[model samples]
Target: MNAYCFTYLFTINYLVVSVIEQMTDARQSYSIAIKNICQSFKESVEKVESIKKDSDTNNNNEILYNFWHVFIEKFQNEAELHENVIQETKAKVVTPLQCIVKHRRQQISRLKAFRTSTDYTLKECAEKVNELQSNYAEMYRIHREILQTKAIKDLLNAHNSYVLQLHMTNAMKAYYHKFVLPQLMQEFEGIVRENIIGFVQIFEYFCSIHTNMFDQLICNINGVQLKVREVSPDSVVSVIVHNLNKNQNPTHWQLIEYLSPDCDCPEILCSNQIIVDNLVKVELRDKFSELKRQFAELSSFMQQNVNIVDTLKTLEKRFDFDTQTEHINLNMHDDIYRKENEIRKAKIALAGIEVQESSNRYATHQEMHSHSSR
Candidate 1:
C-alpha cells in the first residue's frame, strides 16, 4: 500500500474516534436513565408492599387491605414484565454496544499500526527486488548462484507476511459487515417493540386493576340505591316541622345593627340629608343591575333545565301512549283491511266476475286473452 493510504486511514480514524466517544457518553447516559427508572420502580413497589402489610395488621381495614392485595399482585406482574425488558435491552443493545465500541477502537488502532509498518517495508522490498533483478545478468555472467544467502529469503517472507496481514484485515472487515453488524442492528432496532409496545401491554394490565376497583364500587353504589328510597326535597319542610320545639321562642336570632357613622357637623350647622339619600340611590341602582345580571344567568340556566325536563316528560308520555295504543292500532288496521276486502268482493260480484278458489294460480295475460276469445 502507498503512504497516502495510511495517512487517509489515520484521518478517517481520527474523525470516527470522536463520534465513538460521543456514542460511549450516550450509552452511559442511557444506562443511568434505566437505573433511575428501575430504582424508582423498586421504591414504589416497596411503598405499596409496606402499605399492604400495615393494612393487613388492621383487621377492620376491609377496603384498604383488599385494594392493596389486588394492587400488589398486579404490580408484581407489571414489574416482572418491566424487568424482562430491561434485561433484554442490556443484553441485546447496551452490552453489545459497549463491546462494539471497545472492539472497534482496538481494531482501528491495530490496523493503522500494522498497515503503516507494512507500507514502509513494502517500499524497501520493491527497491530490493528491482536491484536484484537489474544485477541478475551481470552477477550470473561474472559468477555462479550464491549459496547461504539469507537476505533474499527473509525479504520474500516479510513481503508475503505483510500481504497476508492486509488480506486478513480485509476479510475481518467483510465478516463484520455481513454478519455481526446486521445481527446487532436487528436486535437493537426492536427497542421500540420490546420496550414501548411491551410497556403499553403491561400498563394496560395495570390500568385494568383500577377499572375493576371502580366497577366494584359502582356495583356497591347500585346495590345501595336499590335498597333505599330516593329522598324528596319537599319532605325536608315536613321533617323540620316534626322536629320543631313548641316551647322555644319563634324568633331566637335577631339581626344585629352595626352603628352607622354620623357626619362631623355642629347641630346649628347641619348639612342636608341628600348626602345619604343620593348615595343610597346610586348604590341601590348598581346593586339592582348586578342582581339582575345574576338573576338572568340563573333564569337562563333554570329555563334550559326545565326545557330538557319537559322534553323528557313528553318522550315518556309518547312511549307510554305507544305501549297503550299498540293493540288498538293493530285492530283498526285489521278492520280497515277487512272492509277493503269486502268492498273488492262486492265489486267483483257487480262486475259478474268469479275467481276459482280451487286453483292457486291466476291466468296470465296471454292465457286470459285466449280464454276470452274461446
Candidate 2:
C-alpha cells in the first residue's frame, strides 16, 4: 500500500508539474502578447499625438496668417484713404503745406503691405511688426513737425495780410487828405458859384468804388477767419487780437468795428489826450496778450492729442504681432502637454501587464508546490 501510494503521489506530482509548466508557458505567452499589445498601443498613441501636434501647429499657423492678412488689409485701406485725400488736396491747392500731407500718405502706402504676407514665416512676422512700428513712429513724428510748419505758414500769411491792409489803408487816407479833399473843396466852391451837378455825380462814383473795395476786404478777412476757425477756433481769436493790438491805429479799430459790428464801442470822453492814448494802448495790449495766451493753450492741447494718437498706433502695432505669436505658442504648448499625457498613459498600461505576468508566475509556482506535497 505504501509503494502504491508513493507511485500515485509521484504520478500526481508529475501531472501537476506538467500543468504548472503549461500554465507558466501560457502565462508567459500572454505576457508577451500583452507586452506586444502595450508596445503597439504606445506606438499608435505616439503617432496619433504626433499627428495631433502637427495638425494643431498647422491650424495655428493658418489662423495667424489669416489674422495678419486682415490686419494688413485694414492698414491698407486707411493708407489708401489718406493717400487719396492728400492727392486730391494737393491737386486742388498746389501749396507747400500739401506736400507734407502727400509725403505722409505715400509713407503709409509703402508700409501697408508689411502687415501681412504668406511669404513671411513666424519669425519674420515678429521682425516685420517691429520694423513697421518704428516706421509708423517716424511717420507720426514727421506729421507733427509738418503741422508745426503749417502753423508757421498760417502765421506768416496773417502777418502779410495785416501789413498789406495797413499800407492800403494809409495810402487811401493820404490820397483822400492830400488830393481828394482839396478837389472836393474846389468842386464845391465851383458848384456853389456855377450851380453845376457834376461834383455830385463824381462823388457818388468815388463813394461806390470805395464801398466795393471795403466790401472786398471784409469778404477776404471773413474767409480767413472761417478757415482759422475750422482749424482752431481759439487760435483765430488770438490772431485777430494780436493784429489789432500790434497796430493800435484808430483806423484799425474803425475797420474792426466796421467788419464786426459786435465790437462797436461808444465814444468815451477823457480829461487829457495823453491819458486817452495810454488807455487805448493798454486796452489793446491786454486784449492781444489774452488772445495769444489762449491760442498757446489750445495749441498745446492739440499737440498732446497728437502724441496720444501716436501712442495708440504704437500699441496697435505691438498687439497685432504679439497676439498672433502668443496664440501659436499657446497651441504648441497644449499639443506638447497632450502628447506627454498620452505617453504617460501608455507607460501605465505597460506596467499593468508586467504586474499580471508576475502574478501568473507566482500562482503557477504555488500550484506546483501543492501537488508535490499531496
Candidate 3:
C-alpha cells in the first residue's frame, strides 16, 4: 500500500512536470512567432518608408498614389495589426502561464515535502504495529502454555494470575488502540488526501491550457477582422489598375477603351467587378476559411480540456471527506471487518479457557471436601 501510494504520487508529479515543460515549449514557440512577426513588421515599415522617399520625386503622382494606396499602406497596416494581435495574445497567455507555472512548482515542492513526512510517519507506525503484533504473539503463546499445564495448577497462584491480568490489560488494549485503529485511519486519510490533491493539480493544468487556447482563438479572430477591413473591393480595384497600367503601358483613356470596346457594355465598372470576382474573391475566401478552421480547432481542444476538468471534479468528489452523507467507501473496509471478527473469536476463546479453569478449581475443592468428610 505504501509503495502504491508513492507510485501514484510520483506519477502525478511526472505528469504535472510534463505539462509544465509543454507549456514552456509553447511559450518558446510563441516567442519565435512573435519575433518573426515583428521582423516582418520592421521590414514592411522600412519598405514603405523607402517607397515614399523614392516616389516623392516621381513625375506620375497617380502611379505613386495607387501604389501607396494598394500595396505599401496595406502591407503596413497588415503587419502592424498582426504584430499587435500576436503581442496581445502572448500577454494574455504567457503572463498567466508564468504565474501558473510558478505556483505549480511551489505546489509540487510542498507536496513532495508532505509525502516525505507522511512516509516517515507511516514507517514509524508500521514498526510500532509490527512490535505490537510480536508482543501479542508472545502473550498468546505464554497464555496457551499456562492453560495447558495441569501439573502447574497449584503453581498458578495469585502472582501468576496478577501477571497474566497485567499483561492482558497492557498489551491487548494498547494493540487495538495504538496499533490498529490509528494505522488504519492514517492509511485511509493519506490515500484520500494524496489523490485529491493530485486531481486538483491536473484540473488546474487543463484549465490553464484551455484558457491559453481560447486566447489564441481571440487572436485569430482579430486577424480575421483586420483581413476583412483591409481586403476591400476598392483595394482590389487599386491592385488591378496598378497591375494593368504596369503591363499595358497605356494612358487612362486607352485602357478604358480597351476594357470597354463594346457600345452596350455593362453600365457599372464591369472591369473592376470582374477582377474582384475572379482574383480577390478566391484569395479572400481561402484566407477566411483558414481563419475559421483555426478557430474551430481551438474551440474543440478547449472543449476536450473542459471534459477532462469535469472528470477530475468527479474523482475529487469521490475522495471528498466533507460529508459522510456521500462517502465513497474504500475497499479496505472488508479486510478491517475481517480482522474485527478474528479479534472477537479470540476474545470468545479466551473466555472459554477462563471458565474451564474455574470449573476445574471448583471441582478440586469439592473433591478435597468430600475426602475430608469421608
RMSD of each: 50.0, 52.0, 39.9
Of 2 and 3, the candidate ahead on TM-score is 3
Best by TM-score: 3
TM-score of each candidate structure, all chains considered together: 0.21, 0.15, 0.24
- CA lDDT, every model vs. true structure: 0.33, 0.31, 0.37
Model 3's lDDT to the true fold?
0.37
Ranking by TM-score: 3, 1, 2
The full ranking of all candidates by lDDT, starting with the best, is: 3, 1, 2
Candidate 2 overall lDDT versus native:
0.31
* Tens-digit lDDT string for candidate 2 (289-325): 5535644554555455456555544444454223235
Model 2 — which ten-residue stretch has the worst lDDT?
267-276
Give the higher-lDDT candidate: 2 or 3. Answer: 3
> Best candidate, lDDT-wise?
3
Across 1-374, the per-residue lDDT of candidate 3 in tens digits comes to 22222333333334333333333343445545434444444454455446446642222223222322332232222212222334443444334434333433443443444434434543444445445444533444455445444322322232233222333333333444444435444543443344334433433443344345555434433433343233333333344334423543211111111122123433432221111122233443453455356545545554554565555455545563322322232222223333333443243223323433343344346556767999
lDDT of 1 by residue, 1-374 (tens): 12222222223223223322333233344544433443444454465446536531222222222332333233232211222233434333334333333433443344334434433433444444344433432333333234224433332333222332332233333433344334333432332123223322332332433345444334333332222222221332232223322222322111112111123322311311111122233443453355356545545554554565455444444442132454454344334333333332233222211111101012123345666899
Output the better candidate (1/2) by TM-score: 1
